[model samples]
Target chain A: MRKILDKLGFTNTNTERKTVTFGDASVVSAPGGRGWTWLSVGFFIILWCLASIFEWINPIFWPPIGAVWEQFVFIFTEGYRNFTLLEHIGLSLYRVLMGFFIGCLVGIPLGFALALSRVMNRLFDPIVEFFRPMPPLALIPLVILWLGIGESAKIFLLFLAAVWIMALATRSGALATKISKIHAAYTLNANKKQILFRVILPNALPEIFTGMRVCMGVCWGTVVAAELVAAEAGVGMMIMVASKFLSTDIVVLGIILIGVVAYAIDVVMRYLEAKLIPWRGKS
Target chain B: MSGLSVRDVSMIYNLPNGEDVEALKHLSFELEPGELLTVLGPSGCGKTTLLNILAGFLAPSSGKIDFDGKEVLSPDPQRGMVFQQGALFEWLSVEQNVGFGPKMMGRKPNEIKAIVDKWLSIVGLADFGKKAIYELSGGMQQRVALARCLANEPDLILMDEPLGALDALTREKMQGLILKLWKETGKTIALITHSVEEALILGNRVFIMAPRPGRLIKEYSLPFAEQGLEKNTREIKKQPDFIEVREEILTMIWDMEEEIMGRQEGNNA
Candidate 1:
C-alpha cells in the first residue's frame, strides 16, 4: 500500500492540502470521439448486413444497409432539396419549440403554486393526476377534432406532452427544498416573494433543468407523432410517406435521421448539465 | 427584559395513523440579549424539535414563543436557522447563497453585495464567492450556511446541530467558529447539540434535557464568559469545572437514554 501510494504520488504533513488531484481515465472520457467509433460503427454494419441476407423476410422489410446508406447520401444532397425535407424539419422544430415554450409558461408557475399552497395543491391535484398518465398520442383524435390539422393541433399535442412532466418535476423540486434553508431565509427577515424567488427558485433549478431535459425528449417524440397525423412534411411525415410505398431505405434513413437529431440535442443538454453542475461528476 | 422568551410551549406531533406524540412538554426558556444558550440531550430527546418550534417551522400544540416581545406565529427573518446539513442550494454559488437573505429582504444590489462580502470574509470564504455549493467540502458548505444565516443579521440565530455531519476535526473547528461569531456579532443564539463537549465549548449557559416527552433536565452556567472568549475556547476545555459539568451532563443523558430504550423495549414486548 505504501509503495502504491508513493507511485501514485501521495504524501502527508498535511502540506499541499489546498488541492487534491486524482488520476484521469482518458479512454473512458473521450471514447467515442476517436478511433473507437470506427470499431462500433463497423460492428453495427456487419450485423445489419448479415440480417439483411436472411431469406425468410421481405426485401423491403429489411433492406441492405448499403441501400440505406446510398439513400442517406442521396437525401443529404440532391434528393433532399427537391423532396421538401428541410422545410419539413424546420416546421417540426418550430412546432415543438412553440409547444415546449407554452408548456413551460404554464407548468413552472402551476408547479410552484401546487407545491407552495395547500389549497392549490388540493384543488389541482385531482385534475393534474387525471391527465398525467394518459399518453399524448391517445389524445390526438380529440385534439384534431377540436383544433383541426393545422399548426395548433400539433402544438397542442406537444404542449400536452411537455407540460405535465414539467409541472410534476417543479412540484417535487419545490417540496424537496430543506426546511432549514427556508427558516434561514425567514430569519433573515425575507418576505414571501423573496422566499419564493430567491430561496425556492434557486434551490429548484437542478430539478427544473432535469425536468426540462425530460420534457424536451417527450416533445421530440410528440412532434414526430404530431407530424404523422395528416401532415405534409416533417421527419415523421417523411417516414410516413416512405412507409406507403414500402421504401425501406427511405424509412431506415428517416428513422436514423430522427435518432441522430435527437441524440445531438441530448448531447447539447448533457453539455449544459456538465457546465451547470461541475461538481456532479467529481463525486 | 429578555431578548427572547418561550412561555409554556407544548408541541405535539400527530402521527399519520392518528397517534399523538409529545415532542416538547411545556418547555420554556428565556435568553438575554447577546446571550448564547446551548441545548443538549440524547437522541430522540426533542432537542431539534424545540429548535424547530423556536424557528417557527412547527406550531406547538399549545403555548407561545416570543422574540423582542412579539409572538413567533411563523418563521421570520429575525430568527435565522443554520441546519445540520448546511442545506445550501446546490445550484447557487457561495456568493448567491450568502446574499439570499438580504436579497429576500429587498436590499439593493450594493447593500446585498456588502453584507455577502462581509459574511463570506467572516466565514473565511472571501475567495470562494463564485464556487457552487456542491463544489464545497462538508466543512466549507457548513461555513457557507453560517455565512448565509449571519448575513441576515437576525436578532436571534437558531442552529440545529449545524456541525453534526462533519468529522471530529471539522466539528471542533466549527465550535470555535461559533464562539468567534458570537463574539463579533453579539447575536442571541440558541443551538441544539447531542455533544456535551460542544455544549460546554460554545454556550454561555448549557440547557440539558431528558429523553422521551423531552423536558429540560438542567441548565449550567460556565465559570468563563462568552464575550471576548474566542481565544479561551481551547483553554476552557482544560478548566476542571468545564470537564466536571460536561461529565455531569453526560451521566444525565446516559441515564435518560437507558430509560428511553427500556421503555421502547417494553412497548415492543
Candidate 2:
C-alpha cells in the first residue's frame, strides 16, 4: 500500500495522511479509498434498474436488473438444466484449469529451453511465429472435427490459446537479464548450472508472472467460445441456450458472471505477482 | 610469474562489415605480488579490454595471461573483477551478495556467513548486510561490490574504474579505503582509471597507455601510494617529484589525444 501511495506521487506533509491504493491492479485510478468503486457500481445498477422499471428500453433487449437477480437465484435454488449454478461454474473452471495447468507445466520449460539454447530456439521459432497471429477461435472447427466436441476439445483450445503466451514470456524474461550480473556470477566461480538456475531463473520470474496474467485473461475470453461446441454445463452453454430461447435476462446474467469471475482471477494474480517478485520494476 | 603475467597480448574486434579494429596491440606487463598497479590511459586506450582479458572474460587474439603461473582460461575465484557499475546482483541483499561466491563454491552455510561478516565489516558495510543492494548509495554499493569480490579471497583484484561514478569527496575517501585495503590484504591490485591524480595516489607502479592500437607507452615507479598508507594523498601530491611526474604523464596523454584526433579527422576527410 505504501508502495502504491508513494508511486502515485504523494508527497510527505507535516499533517497526518491517509494511505491510498493508487495503483491497485483491481481498482483503476482509485485515488484514496474504495468508496468510489462501490458508489459508481451502485449508481450504475440504479440507473439500469430505473431504465428497466420505466421501460425506457425494450425488456427483450436489456432485461431489468431485478429480473436478472431473480434468474440468478432461480439457477442456484433449482438447477440450470440438471446441475446447479455452482456446478456449472465448477465444471467450466475444471476444464480451463486442466488445460491451462498442463499447458503451463510443459510450455514454460520449453520456453526456458528456447531462450537458453540456440538449437531449441531455432527448432521452435518457426512454429511459434507461424501460430502466433492466429486466434484460438480459428482452430475451433478443426478441434471439433478432430476431438468430436468432447471435454478434450475445449481444454485443448484453452491450452492452445495459453501455451504460446507462456513460452514467449519466458523467452523475453531471460533476454532482459543483465549481462553484468551473469558475469558477476561467473567471476564468483559459478558453474553453468548455478548461473542458469540462480541468476537467470529469478530474473525471468517477473516477466513469467506478467505472461501468466495475460494467459489467464486469454483463457477466460476463449473459454466461452470453446464451450459453445457442446458443453453439458457451463456459463457459456447457459448463455448459448438462453439466447437461442430469447431468455435475455439469463444471457445478461451469464455475461456478467463471466466478467466478475475473470476480474476476480486477475486480482488474485496481481496479489501473487506482488508477493513473488517484490524486486520487480524497482531496478 | 609469482604474480600476474600478461605476455604480449593483442586483441582484434571484427566488425560486422568485414573490418577489423585493433583494440589492443602487443600489450605486455607484469603485476608483482602485493603491488598496486594502476593502468592509466585515454578513452580509447583499451583499459577495459585489458581488464576483461585479465579477468578471463575474453581471450586475447595473440598472447597469454598467467595468474599465479597458471594460464588464464576463464573466470576463477582467484581473479575477482569489480565492474564500473551495476556489478552486484540487484536481487540479493548485501550479505547474500558477499556470500554468493562461497555459496557457488558449495561452502557450508556457516562458513559463508563468517566470510560475509568479515568482508562486510572490512568494507564498513557491516550494518548494511541486511539491506538490498539497490537501497545503497553509489559509494556504499561500490563498497559492497568490493566486499563481494574480496569475500571470494581472490589473489588479484581488478577494478575497472570502480570509483569513476562517485563524487570527488567520495572518490577520495574510496581511494583512501583502497590504499588501506591494499596495505591490509597484500593483494595484487590492477586498477584502471582515466584520472591521473587517482592513478598517482593509488598506484606504486603506474602504466601509461596510448590509444589507436592501445599499448603501454610509459611506466612509473612512485612512492606516493606507499606514502598514502601513512600520509594524506593531498600532501603527497604536493611533493616536487610527484608534481613533475604528473605534468610529464599529462603532456604524454595530451599528445596521444591530439594524434588520435588527427587520425579521426583524416578518416573523415
Best model number under lDDT: 2
Please list the residue runs of candidate 2 whose C-alpha ends up more than 4 Å from where it truly belongs after superposition: A1-42, B234-244
Best by DockQ: 2
In model 1 chain A, the worst 10-residue window by lDDT is A12-21
Residues B1-269 of candidate 1 have per-residue lDDT tens digits of: 55989889887888999998887898888899998998998877788888888888888899888889899888888888888775776667899888877877779999999999999999999999998787788999899999988888889999988989999988878888888888888899999888788888888888988765878878888745463274556677788887888788778878887888899899999
Q: Report the CAPRI category for model 1.
A: medium
Tell me the tens digit of each residue's lDDT in model 1 across A148-184.
Answer: 9988889999999888988988999889777766766
Would candidate 2 be rated incorrect, acceptable, medium or high by CAPRI criteria?
medium
